[model samples]
Target chain A: SQTIHQWPATLVQPVGSPLSLECTVEGTSNPNLYWYRQAAGRGLQLLFYSVGIGQISSEVPQNLSASRPQDRQFILSSKKLLLSDSGFYLCAWVKTSGGDEQFFGPGTRLTVL
Target chain B: QKEVEQDPGPLSVPEGAIVSLNCTYSNSAFQYFMWYRQYSRKGPELLMYTYSSGNKEDGRFTAQVDKSSKYISLFIRDSQPSDSATYLCGPYGQNFVFGPGTRLSVLP
Candidate 1:
């Protein structure tokens, strides 16, 4: 079985501070990774997606960026955080076989104050 | 206009009642439909996936997709309090277009 791990489960960051959130998947290789943000009572907003290492596609332009440093390790980072950057971050993985069902991690709740 | 539209309902229903959740899409290219459930402050969990235009049933959950009408539905039989969460419908093709989601509360 494949499992995704994301941390820290919750984060509180000061405005203009740096942000880093990590997500790692086990039991799968060369999986498609995606970063999504969800606001209160809102649908998910796709931030970035990577089909392979060092390859990322940004859906919406913002302060946040994503990187796939390894085959199963994806990281979301920001040099300086903004108040609008606060939201629940989710990491998801999909098989390369064109299956649309994506498995998601527990998620990280970020609050920029 | 949005690619997909869903009623953002804080729908409250009694336990054991039947629940119906729906979504409409403007794109006909979406051949795959899916329903996801998300708890408070958690990631969305895929509850059901259906292809083309038809109905698929898994246990107490039934997913229906009508590509002709560009509409989809999810039906929960004998709903439980544990089923309280936000239901999001998505249309899949190159990627996915998700609806705003509907929050359901099953009162016990």
Candidate 2:
């Protein structure tokens, strides 16, 4: 059984502050990780995806960035946050064995005031 | 047009009634489809996944895909209040392209 974990379940920060959200997966290795932001009543917006360590793809250009420092650890960071960054931040992972089923972690609710 | 489209319905239904959710996609290369259910303020959970056309059943839920029409559907039978949530559908091509989601409320 694989599990995805995310930290700082809820965060409130002022605009221009730095942001760091972490996601880790257990019971799986070499998984493809993704970062998504979902706004109220909107669909999930893909931000970044990592196929392997040190490999990240940006699906949308924004204030955020992602890194895969380890096989099971992924981090989403920003040097400065914007008011528009307020949304539900989700981290998901899919098996690397050519499967498309994605498993998501409990999201981080970010409110940039 | 968006790659995938779904009615963002705040659809309301009574308990024990049948609930139907649908989505449409424009890509002909999509061969895999999935339905996800998300409770308020929670992550979406994968409810069903099917390949190509035809229907797949799991317990009280059924997932239908029509590749010819690029239409997909999810049906929930004997719905409960617990079934009140937002449902999302996606077609897998180069990636999973999800719809805007349909919010369903099964009133008890």
Judging by DockQ against the true structure, name the best candidate: 1
Q: Give me the TM-scores of chain B across the candidates.
A: 0.98, 0.97
**What is candidate 1's TM-score against the reference?**
0.97
Q: Root-mean-square deviation of each candidate, in angstroms? A: 0.9, 0.9
Q: For model 2, which pairs clash?
A: none
Regions more than 4 Å wrong, model 1 = none
Per-prediction fnat:
0.76, 0.66
State the lDDT at A25 in candidate 1: 99
Sorted into a CAPRI-style docking class, model 1 comes out as medium
List the lowest-lDDT window of 10 residues for candidate 2 chain A.
A93-102
Docking class of 2: medium
In model 1, what are the clashing residue pairs, if there are any? Answer: none
